[model samples]
Target: MGEQVSKQATIVGMLWTGGTPKAKEVEENMASYFNVLQGFLLYFYGSTVGAGPTLSSNLHQSVMQVVNSSFNLMKDSVSSYGSRSKDQKVAVPVLVGKVWEACSGLKKAPATNIAAIGRAMTQVAVSMKDVLREMRELKPDSGGQEDDQQTSGGVAGDGDGNEDDDDDVGDMGNDLSPEEMKVAELAMEVVSDLLLVIKELIRSITGLLKMEKADTSGSFVDSLEKLLKSSQVIGAQIDELGACLYPPQEVSTMEAALKKISSSLNGIESEVEDLKGSTDTFVKACSGLRGSIKQLELVLSCCSVGQLEEQLTNTSLSH
Candidate 1:
């Protein structure tokens, strides 16, 4: 399967990059390539999967959801064959990469129902952690110009040597006013608190997973699926929040993210009573998240009012 996926990814890259096995020929063979890959997935997801495999139903369904998304992306690429956009050329390779991930993911997918849900939520937490780390790199826009090599972290200079890379993220703390930097710091706090929510949420999931003879019944599996779906919802809203956390903070988007996060948290919390051995840690995390949101909103409102007053004062002086 890996070799097959490698061939597909390589071919797609070649097709878009004008490599061997001309695009027209590969275009004709695209369906066969897709079928070969789809067959592997079907072998796993089909009746053979139920031939006394340790993989739970939840694992099968979760894998299908992501694999289906990869299929849709590939279909779009095929449909736009002759007129691939520049972005599509770049993305087509990546979309193929996701198929590779979906297939490779089977080995990593948890066999136990509760643990499968835990694994899914953990992936979300890892993503949230990445956003939090990047948010740390964000410094208030000093209207500074960076060359191609220099990044938000700092310039690639102070090079001791390639063999012994110093590899320090540039701390430009002195570049911005404390007042300006505080907005980013507050945003970071929100991200930090959200991570706490994920941490607590994962604890609940793993707790349920650890129960002696964990549930495999349909109704229980349905509830777990709902939790995974809610986690995905929270994960998406976090992405939105991360995008808006930069300078000139997007208050409306941030507020909308908060609203959605609250709703998702409510859904997550609803399962607490039903999940055996789960604790109230998520409840406490939710409270902490609310506090962080309120703090960030305070700064946003202060900045908005300050801007309005400055404009009003400028108008009075002009009059």
Candidate 2:
């Protein structure tokens, strides 16, 4: 079974590293790649309890390798097709973002060393952010000459009177204008940053859980409190990122949807705060009960059975 799993993982890795294709092909490849990732994630979830830690760790590393390779392949495709038609150019990065989103389930796998997985995911997020920044930087400048050429080319194509040929030429020349590319790049950056913040939040929460499990002196509580605070901050960041992606003037529906999400996040934050307070109260109550029990045990140790029976009867009468 292990051998078969390894073989399957190897095949998927190959598909990710497959040479750059056109925009549509890139999207298809990414979909297949993420499907394989999802499969491995589910396999790990089912097998983690019985699997050795070393084996699970190795499997995780292999999956991350594929993820990183896929990310790089996406970056290359985006750069290569940056001058392609607006739809094609935009599709590559959007697909990449979706692939990252799909992998968000990795943190939930029941593994012994989730910290390692979280670190790997953080690296992937960082890579994605870098790619977005690169895309923004690659946004082309305004070109009066290019526009003039397009106008002349349109007239020339019409004169040829072959509609099919004209269509082909038009498609080739439909590359995004500078302003449009800038908008697309900015949108992609916001999406990528949102994903990054979410990944970081996941990593921090995983770390917090590990600390809590290993704690004996309640040191983890402070870290847990800090993590909750950080979660609130990240939630706010997500709201800002959403606003950047969907401005109120241009996409009112999206803006309304984002507002709903922001509200939900706020609700979650309040719940986390309430949970923290409840936990502290429970711990203090347990401590007090333990101390009272210890005192009662000391007092009872000095009494014989007859004396204890008399004391109990007197106390009941007084009550």
Candidate 3:
């Protein structure tokens, strides 16, 4: 599949270099491009026949992403093939570049349904970590020390000369007033707690992956797929929770995100239990995460109440 896509890439790339491909040439190559994708689909489906239950979830999503994105770019490349030289030069090559990317991506797609879902959950963990990193950088209203930050560059590089993730996380204490510091501190704790939740979620995914399922029935795979879907929902709500953490924190929105995350976690626990998978460690992780989430919700509720009281007090003074 990869080799076929590469050849098509070279062949289609030539169309724009010399001149506009003839209409017949465009039509023929368009068909060829499609054939390559079709061949891949056949291979993917054939290889994962045992994983049909997950076909509607991560496995299916991964295959379609490669196929559909490649298809769209290939179609655009063909359209550019029949256009003016200037148009062809500007658009076709970029489309061809993307097609090459899709080709390369084909080799990297997960070979197993478990791996596909694992990748999805790992991606969620990575995103949540990014949010935590960013939130940790949240400064006091008086602000962070810009001069210190300027000088702190290159200070944390490792032996590989690769800068650590903490390179971006500036000094935690500079000129923070009490109230602002409290907010920043609590906000950081909330993000940190969320990160732990995703960590536990990934661990649970790992446990499932390590299990040997004697039951390869459709229902068994379906249950696993449901777990993947729940992980995805938790991932999304984590994103929402992160986004709502900015100034004047949207307590309701954050609460809503937390609620969804808690619900999804419950769903995951239920699905795993149905699979008769070992759930003791996972259950404990979920319990700990739920505790953290409750604390965050309580903090948000306090902030909400404080904001309301301040507004009310100001209104009374004005009256």
Candidate 4:
């Protein structure tokens, strides 16, 4: 059973790495034009309705182009992944971000503009640090340092019980040298940046919904609707990530983090929905104000000079 489990893990790892070669090629393409295109899409979205036929068609085309091109580029590169150099492995996180961005339309989503991409790049860095941490956990003892702690009556084993499982050991590959540790530290910085950007996106969408309510009555309804839908998509992605990172037994911390994000998403969702009724109230208020203004204009227009003067004087005296 142990051997079988190890084999299964091996297979899974192979499957994960299988896409790496193509990942590298597509990422190379992304480095040159993806960021620029992302900028244009963001500008266009900010200026136009994300709901219209033209913008929707363009968005769909851009997404499909990126996805199809990336998949085609990655096809020949999968199986020879591990044999690739360290530099190549290091690029994996960035490539992963690009692929996800394309598939999710996160790049064009108002919540995840170019700024968010910058932040995601930072998370990619922390993810790399996680890679190094795994490596350190697998390091061999130098000299007789910290004599290998063994089970009471069993062969001296690494903390993990899988003795002789070379595949498992390699999966824990690489103790961080001092320099590698620095790289990991840098990666953490990136994760922080990414989180901040995501937060900002949430805030931006919330602000837009607020504005929509204030202007053009319920004209902003469709924008709010799209915002809610986009937010839910993001919430789902975050939940997926939380699940992947946390095992059932150790899920509390991950759950807490996810709950915070979900709460923010729900709050914004509620705010957007409230605008449906609020927009109508604003419209009525504006209509009443217009009537009052027209009445004042007529009263002033029909007033005699002395009567208008007396009226102004009376109004001032009342104040």
Clashes of each: 0, 0, 0, 7
Model 3: worst 10 consecutive residues (lDDT sum): 171-180
lDDT of 2 by residue, 86-189 (tens): 55444545444444443443444444433543444454456546545544444343458856766787788875534456664744533444333434454454
What value does the lDDT take at residue 128 in candidate 4? 40
lDDT of 1 by residue, 1-319 (tens): 5356546655665665662345667566677667766765775556433212223555666467555745755675665466536665567667767766665766665656666667678888889889888777766544435433345234344442333233323443323334546766876787788888878877776666444254434556666677778888988988888787554456778778878877887777786657663466777787888888788778667666357547667888999
Could you tell me which 10 consecutive residues in candidate 4 have the lowest summed lDDT?
242-251
- Candidates ranked, most accurate by TM-score first: 3, 1, 2, 4
lDDT of 4 at 308: 51
Model 1 TM-score, all chains together = 0.54
lDDT (C-alpha, whole model) for all candidates: 0.65, 0.46, 0.66, 0.41
lDDT of 3 by residue, 1-319 (tens): 6667767777877876777667888888888877887897787767666663543355566566667667666767766754655864677677667767766766676665566666766776787778778766666544346545544544653243335436635443333444434544665565565556556555655566534345465565567678778877876876786666565556788778878888887887787777566356656666777777777777667657456557667888999
Residue 63 lDDT in model 4?
A: 51
Model 3 score (lDDT): 0.66
Return whichever of 3 and 4 wins on TM-score.
3
